[model samples]
Target: MKVSIKHLFAAVTLFASSTVLADVLADIKPLQDRWAEVNYALPEDDREKAFAELLANADKVVGGNPDKAEALIWRGIIKSSYANAKGGLGALSVAEGSKADLEQALKLDPTALQGSAYTSLGVLYSKVPGWPIGFGDNKKAKELLLKALEQNPQGIDPNYFYADYLAGKRDWAEALRYLEIAKAAQPRPGRESADAGRQQEIAALLAKVQKKLKK
Candidate 1:
């Protein structure tokens, strides 16, 4: 048996690369959780300052790691900056950038990034409409949500987004199922809000959405 020096070097490099990726994947989630908390705490009337903070953090996430897939998730999220709060053709500009990032993320690694790219696209579509139009699209939303679920059934964002879509479509049963899954995935209290307030709000909204859909 003859093992060449090249083979040994290649094996070492692969191991190192995998370790780096694992570390990044591990770190990204906590950052994501903090950002989610911040988003939840922000007042309902506006999302600009929150969006600004979100974009800044997301940029940091992408900047810290040059990996295409990892960068893509942050980029996709940043792209949808004010789509939900101040949507219009103006918001469309941001959405375009977000779309590009998610697409790149998918191309790089559809399975990695915890299906973040797909989940983000699902979220954006659910909140937005057709091109040059407003911010809302059920069909596209459903498609992306299913894709995200297919990629990562256990992911929180996917469950949240998909659950929202189901509620939008008046599928209360399914929506509840997914929302429960999302809640179970991480019960941690949001940092943005003092303590239980965020939880109460989220729970209330979930209940309201479910009730509306049930009717």
Candidate 2:
């Protein structure tokens, strides 16, 4: 029997895509549990199918309404998360869709949903790496994260995301500041313990980053 490299590559790609989808869905399960009625019990592969349904539904809804904005935001968010789950497969579609949804949301009303549009963009940017992950814009990520914070100075979501961003840049001090700020916000049960564990992880990573910076 003869082996073809192309076939091997295809198999690997399929495997990798499957793995990413599994992991992303796993991560979302908790979030789904937290948001009971808002989330559905659909398999990962059916996410795009759901998005198509949502887009069709949105078309019937009135544009420029707060409700419309909310619908668009969530549609975009689901697409983004699904794309992420697929490890860049359909990522361009997801990123573009997310932007369009948020754009429509902003056009409807920039202040709608407590600046959720900005927060969603920030989430998209933070998770999807810049220049490599199809449409990750770290600069825009920072700007949107800041907007989210300004919109809700008392929210933990923004703080947690911003802290994650700061950690990505290896800015330990700044990340620590944001993490500490997030600590004061309402935490999920045992989240404080998780945060403490994460703190230790950050400390370890920062030590390496600092050492590399020195050399």
- What would the per-residue lDDT of candidate 1 be over residues 22-99, giving only the tens digit for each residue? 777665666566555555666766576667667766777778775658766765775575455556567776886787
Number of backbone collisions per candidate:
5, 0
Q: Could you give me the TM-score of model 2 versus the true structure?
A: 0.57
Question: Which residue pairs in model 2 clash with each other?
Answer: none
Q: Evaluate all candidate structures by whole-model CA lDDT and list the values in order.
A: 0.70, 0.63
Q: Once model 1 is optimally superposed onto the true structure by TM-score, how far is the C-alpha of residue 157 displaced, in angstroms?
A: 1.7
lDDT for 60 in candidate 2 is 39
User: For model 1, what is the C-alpha lDDT against the true structure?
Assistant: 0.70
Off by over 4 Å in 1: 1-10, 22-34, 44-46, 53-67, 131-137, 186-202, 209-215
- For each candidate in turn, the TM-score is 0.74, 0.57
lDDT of 2 by residue, 10-76 (tens): 9999999667546543443333332322223456676555555544544433342334555566556
Question: Model 2, which residues run further than 4 Å from truth?
Answer: 1-67, 129-133, 187-215
